[model samples]
Target chain A: MDTNQPRWQRRKDARPAEIIEAALTLFVDKGFAATRLDDVATQAGVTKGTVYLYFANKEELFKAVVRETILPNIESGEHLLADHQGTWAELLWILLERWADRMEYSASTGISKLMIAEASNFPDLARFYVEEVVMRSRKLFATVIQRGIDAGEFRPVDPVMATRAVISPLMLIKVWKQSFSLCDTEPVDLKAFARFHYELMMQGLASR
Target chain B: MDTNQPRWQRRKDARPAEIIEAALTLFVDKGFAATRLDDVATQAGVTKGTVYLYFANKEELFKAVVRETILPNIESGEHLLADHQGTWAELLWILLERWADRMEYSASTGISKLMIAEASNFPDLARFYVEEVVMRSRKLFATVIQRGIDAGEFRPVDPVMATRAVISPLMLIKVWKQSFSLCDTEPVDLKAFARFHYELMMQGLASR
Candidate 1:
């Protein structure tokens, strides 16, 4: 809207985010292997040449989409973990609540789907995502579970397995909603489902 | 080697199955949209013309892969449900055991990954897969849960939601093994994880 500003400078600033958003939609819709970079550029309202200016290739663009959409949220999750002072159960409940609010309901959730779907095809991207996103999220859960066990607030178990059990249903439901929920008539209330899972997991983890 | 069998008759019977198997591998690797029918035909040691004799199109070949690999196992599951006379917990545990044994260590799990990855782009295939595969599997769990609730053997809970909860971790772990498990150094013991999940869920569902 700034008529006086240089067009190249304005386009340069906005294209990366705009292109990333468009690419995420395509990747989520078409999947990584099926999606074409030229189509992504077209969808983002830019030329293929223009798209190449920001990303060197399709893989780089794919990487940018994952990095741009998911990494910020992961960083904030780390911040939440560092700053939180609460019951471990409450912290987990809150952490998952934030995950649901931030990632599950948005385009970012597609990053999770894309990684799960195409990890074998793109091992390097998958490995990077694990290192950057999945492990960080697991550590958040594992740390809280460890805290709970150390504080005599929860029963002893493998913190890692406990973390997997706690998160599996949540991740399944999220992926199910995006992928298979469309074909089902009886819908599971996701918010209530999350609440119930938290309660059930807490009960299972409770110190006897 | 059955020397008595005619060559064309032998090739005719085996080619369809071989084509389906090769298609599953390609669909799992390259995804539905990117996988060419020609490559699948060649991989199966047949001409594109021969492939067309069995399947009408690439989508049909994809559907055949799913049908051949998954449908028989689902039928057996349905038969197990029909034949079972046991506690719901036992039945549920048994159902998951069969699922893990049949699906987790095989290429069939890749169908799950392909469906999730490509569902948005191919809603018809997704819907068909749901009708043919997912609903049947969910119905197996739902029926067991409903029977338990009706007989007062388990606590009252939404059978459908509870069924979703029961299958969630099993499905998640299967998909995770195919996808992210390669990157993980510390592998979760899947058998122990399944047994523990069953126990935890039964504890939650216990009426006493």
Candidate 2:
């Protein structure tokens, strides 16, 4: 798009994103404890000192990975909720469809599995993830569910608990793809799985 | 109860179970790739030779750990399905209640988290778990769901996918307890979580 720009300038501008992309790949493949910053530098085709220029440390690099890759999805979902003009059920369906689409196709889906696997070993990172990503995403869902309850479109369930219930199946599928799908003979159809899970949640949350 | 039995004979009889318990603990705390049989032997208070006497290798030890700790829960769940005498909703409630009780209080609950974390590294073992534990458990839930549909007690949905929907939350909770619970400021109450999940599922699956 910017072919007129100098190649050196373009490379300089792209370096941080390229490093973050490399870091996400490595973090997802290897647990946080086993991944090294120098390896990330090698994968990104940058020097380790260059990596330190963009990121203060491995944890910061990881935080950047989360911020760059996942936070956008959360932001988009939040925007969807804020701008939605339809039945709460329709809004929920759209939000989940976007989510399932990302989880099915995006490399960032593996970050959740990585977090689950390595959370105990890195308590600070885990807490950061919980506060930054987990709670934020859950808040988005909770807001939608609470609005549904207020509008008498959903059953009067606690928004916090309802958010957990709605999210758990999606979380399970993400973890499954990263781990068990390696040996799973009959892998789930991601679309069917998502459709059925959303249907179940819709039915469960509907006002009677 | 067996106070009259000789100490050596009793210890000999208990060796396999002791080793299995130790293996489960180590395998859960440290993943399969990181856990060494010698460490398990040490934890079990047995010699390396003693461990080998019972288990052919680490894989065998892991398998035995599953069979000892997890299979029993599955077996008992099967028995509950076979012996149930109630409405399908009530039966499902009881089944989920029992499962939640075990997950909250049992050592075996950690095995689910362990398998999720290490399944990719150990594909053969993952396949083993899928066949022995996952499929068997799903079959139990599918049978109940199928019966409910046939008897006009629940909505018609794919029993296989429905079984997945039902189990996913429980899986998430198990993983959370082992990993994110370390840093989660507002950890969920296990009973309330189980109850709400069960309620949500029951509503989702109802014939209404």
Candidate 3:
């Protein structure tokens, strides 16, 4: 042990991250209403007081967990869109694929369910998630669509509506997978699904 | 009040329906974990014993409410599909449009949130919803797609996957509207949105 290190240094910076990870797992498994802070403390292998040092209460802990886990995921998609340039269809497909991947593994789905359950009472959290995460992601997609339209890589389309068109099916697929665990029935080749969605999105439903 | 009905008839039939209706409104507003049977009775203007006479517990009341509200909505869709015929694109647009209309005002969205929150703990309810509602709806869409494929209204396509593609976007739109209330800022014209979705569903991304 490094005895000379300050007390703050002794508690590794990673401890907060680790605590959030543990909290999310518990929240997803037991739900926000049912999960106790004691359980999270035990799961994180920290004293209850130590847990309190980082979070004021269970609701605060949940909000922190959601902010830490989901916001970055959406930001990463924005980062990708900013860094990459491709055909409109290709760019949209990449974003959709990334979204599907995130929903498949992340605790965001569970957090979303918890938010939905509590939104009538906790409208603030619902509004925060929508404004901070959902709308942010939608705006990013809309920007990409507008860019594509300007470049003539895509038709002159309503970027906002087009973004919804591109993203909504993927969102539904995630809900289906979460609500039904359809992922377990068989390995859905997501690449194929992505391509299928992309094709439907760019063209009208008319025979040549 | 008309008390001419047989004692068993009112207790067995009308009372249960009333209790379930009251439960649905309470559950939609307060959520499953927070709502009490006493609240349901108060909301219905009935005695606590009247609720217990119909439902064994809160869970039973929830299930009964879900069954009563959702089953009829789904059955109505089935009836609509059975009585109508058109081009695959036309029929799908109509079905999805009707679905969007039905979900707009129904308590199903709130119930769905509750189901997702509790599904890990109550897997039976989740399974019941998936099997009873989701699978059945998917089958109906697949039947329409198959008819389209046979009639040369659509290019050769996998009806199951096509149905998923056709319906998934609409489901996502519903989640977006209900969960985030995104439509408040930019209200989606459901008819036009459904038409756009249907057109995209029938065609691929390639330029005509």
- The per-model DockQ list reads 0.58, 0.76, 0.45
Q: Candidates ranked by TM-score, best first?
A: 2, 1, 3
- Each candidate's fnat: 0.60, 0.73, 0.50
Write model 1 residue lDDT over B71-189, tens digit each, in one string: 88878877887888888778889888887676646798878878887787788999988888888888888998898898898888888778877888888887788788889766777
Off by over 4 Å in 2: B1-4
Displacement of the residue B153 alpha carbon in candidate 2, Å: 0.7
Ranking of predictions according to lDDT: 2, 1, 3
lDDT by candidate, in order shown: 0.82, 0.88, 0.71
Candidate order, DockQ descending? 2, 1, 3
Runs of candidate 3 with Cα error greater than 4 angstroms are: A1-11, A56-60, A182-191, A204-208, B1-13, B52-60, B176-178, B182-189, B205-208
- How well does candidate 1 score on lDDT at residue A80? 75
Q: After superposition, how far is residue A99 of candidate 1 from its true place, in Å?
A: 1.9
Residue-level lDDT tens digits of model 2 in A1-208: 5999999989989999999999999998887888999999999999999999999999999999999999998999888888899998888888888888888779999998889888888899999999999989999999999999999999899898888888888888899899888767668887788889888888888898
lDDT of 3 by residue, B108-163 (tens): 66676666555555666677767777778888888877777777777776676677
TM-score for model 1?
0.86
Candidate No. with top TM-score: 2
Across A76-194, the per-residue lDDT of candidate 3 in tens digits comes to 87888778866756777777777767776777666765655455555666677677767887898898888877777776767777777777766665555555573234335555776
